[model samples]
Target: MTIADLAGTPAPEAASATARVRTPRLRRYAMTAPTFFAVEYAINPWMDTSTPVDAALAVRQWDALRSTYRTLGHTVEMVEPVAGLPDMVYAANGGLVVDGVAVVARFAYPQRAGEAVAYADWMSSRGFTPHATQYVNEGQGDLLVVGPTILAGYGFRTDLRAHAEIAELTGRRVVSLELVDPRFYHLDTALAVLDDSTVAYYPPAFSDDARAQLRRLFPDAVEVSSADAYVLGLNVVSDGKHVLLPANAVGFAEQIGELGFEPIGIDLSELFKGGGSVKCCTLEVYS
Candidate 1:
């Protein structure tokens, strides 16, 4: 059965629901410009203090991703980037917006803690009632929306306890998954939700139990190779039809193409130094 078929999944926000059909979705997303993007601290495995980050290159790559989204007929909104907050460019970690409810992020590390307050204010400005979580949650980096189901990952950046808080905030069924690999610190690092009905992931990133749950839920799921996962390939943004991904993840591009989705590759190798790509740079604004 599909994730949509799961019991207790939240119903559409509107009382009069339209039929679920395949059409080009005009997606709305929130992004922060990499005006102050940098790698001053190491929170994840991909970050290194000694490595020189080309902020100019990062901005160029980010602008290209934004342009690609607009070209595909998607709305891209900018959140003002704060100086001294280099990681602000990874906007997906700002919050999780579902059915007009914005569950703001509670970052695990002190380095990123200030970002929560910044995103909370931004979310309120965009017409969402911000709901704060007591448990540590890093927004879409760990919490992914699958139709009405929320796939949450923990054992690294996010605390597992936050999954229940997420359910209360969004009124959706939260499927808690464990991230076992240090390299795949966040769920988006190892998994991609292709559409409402399907997902692709790296098996070794998850725990045995989490892997079992995934296998049972998405039998047709694409299993990605280490070659692609290492390059943060699964960190992609999809509007059901087209997927925007890092240009280096050729293997993942081919796999998603087999699933009949157009994979649009954009180079954000500079941003990868900060530990994110297309999906990490974009946060879906559900209404």
Candidate 2:
């Protein structure tokens, strides 16, 4: 289908209405800018930027990472600039579009608090009906939709209250877990749905219960080491059999290649500094 054809479809009906019984699609995904992504400057008190070169390099890295998605056949639409908050420009990060509807997020940071409003406007302008998360939760990075189930991370960026609210909004069973590792504040940092039945994850980031739940849901998950996981770009975006990973991760790219699926890698060093990989920077909505 053409890009115009893809973008021209009307938003799906509200989840509460009977008209909302269509199958959810997962065709395209999006990513945001890496500029102004340094949390140390805006949110992190410990962040000290001793040089301007570091900031310039960070922006360069972010641009390179965003282009990597395009090289993989996935459509990359640049969300316009949001003054002061560069992260806000990547409209995909503000909400999750399941099927054709947009699920708006409740940002945990006060600086990011305005993203939801801007994202809602973006969706509406595109003929999408936006849904909001209950309580406070960062939408793009906190939740992952695998088949019929939504895996949500609770703690740090997303709260339990938001989990319950998401369940109420979509009427889908939200499997919630408390993130044990503070470093990986979001689930994308440690876990990923490779396919409907297969997953790639770092064991140290998941609790016993969460691991059990994962096995029960996806009995075919291929466990990889945290070090390998880092190299694997475990959270890479998937389109049918195609997977996009980080360019620097050679071993992980080779493993994915061995699986009969095409693997494409791009350099994402700048985005990593902001605590996001391929998946975190984008939101995929399919029908």
Candidate 3:
């Protein structure tokens, strides 16, 4: 069945009708400018590089997205994009930062491995205690911080061994969730942490065991439609209140609104050719 067919499935009742609303706090983010386009074919399932990406349009869309964050009262830092690194625009993969500590990613692909050093240097210069891991990890692309724990993904671009290294380095509990679908290669693609107590995810992207674990941990999780998931809908950026996602993900946006979040959609269709959306372009830096 298609995602539209699953749209009718009733969402789980929220844990509380009046969930404790937290004030939106200032968020620091890291982003990169999309100045190059080498994605001519699908490296991951999400990209159809053969379709031809409009490089100029991609830059405009990215700029608009950066502007959106600034307009929302957030500080966005930039990491200088290197030549020949087309995928560098997805800044979230550079490193995972939490509580002033950064664990730099050792990318699984050689194409992206150079980004690790640049990100580490940037993080170190910014007063973050940078920790470089020997294991292959894709930074925030596969690691997400929710509440006190780190939700990590493996069985795709990231090595499972990186989980322990990150946990040891950050002293945060790392819960490993295996990604079952190639399209949802990163944890951020399949899951969005809306707040400390809430998350939105696409169940089919994860293994059954992982889904069960997610249910146990986040009972108030919102399940996105398959249609939304197909367009990387759950790959969203959310502060405590506002959620930014792709404009085409109407179903997911509606669901987010119902949960008391202000869902703001921005058109990032051009970048979608590179296998990413809002979350992939944004790396949250926690103080």
Instruction: Kindly report which residue pairs in candidate 2 clash with one another.
Output: 25-286, 25-287, 26-286, 30-282, 247-266
- Cα-based TM-score, every candidate: 0.92, 0.79, 0.91
Expressed as tens digits, the lDDT of each residue in 223-249 for candidate 1 is 999999999999998888677777778
How accurate locally is residue 150 in candidate 3, as Cα lDDT from 0 to 100? Answer: 93
The predictions' CA RMSDs to the true structure, in order, are 8.6, 9.5, 5.7
Which stretches of model 1 miss by more than 4 angstroms? 1-22
**Whole-model lDDT per candidate:** 0.86, 0.63, 0.84
lDDT of 2 by residue, 63-174 (tens): 6555545544556665555667745633445877776667887887877777788777767877889887657877757778877888898767788788887777777779
Total backbone collisions for each predicted model: 0, 5, 0
Q: Candidate 1 or 2, higher TM-score?
A: 1
> What's the distance in Å from true for residue 216, model 1?
0.5
Number of the candidate with higher TM-score, 2 or 3: 3
Clashing pairs in 3: none
Please give the distance, in angstroms, between residue 283's alpha carbon in candidate 1 and its true position after superposition: 0.8
User: Candidate 3, TM-score vs. the true structure?
Assistant: 0.91
Model 1: residue 286 alpha-carbon error in angstroms? 1.6
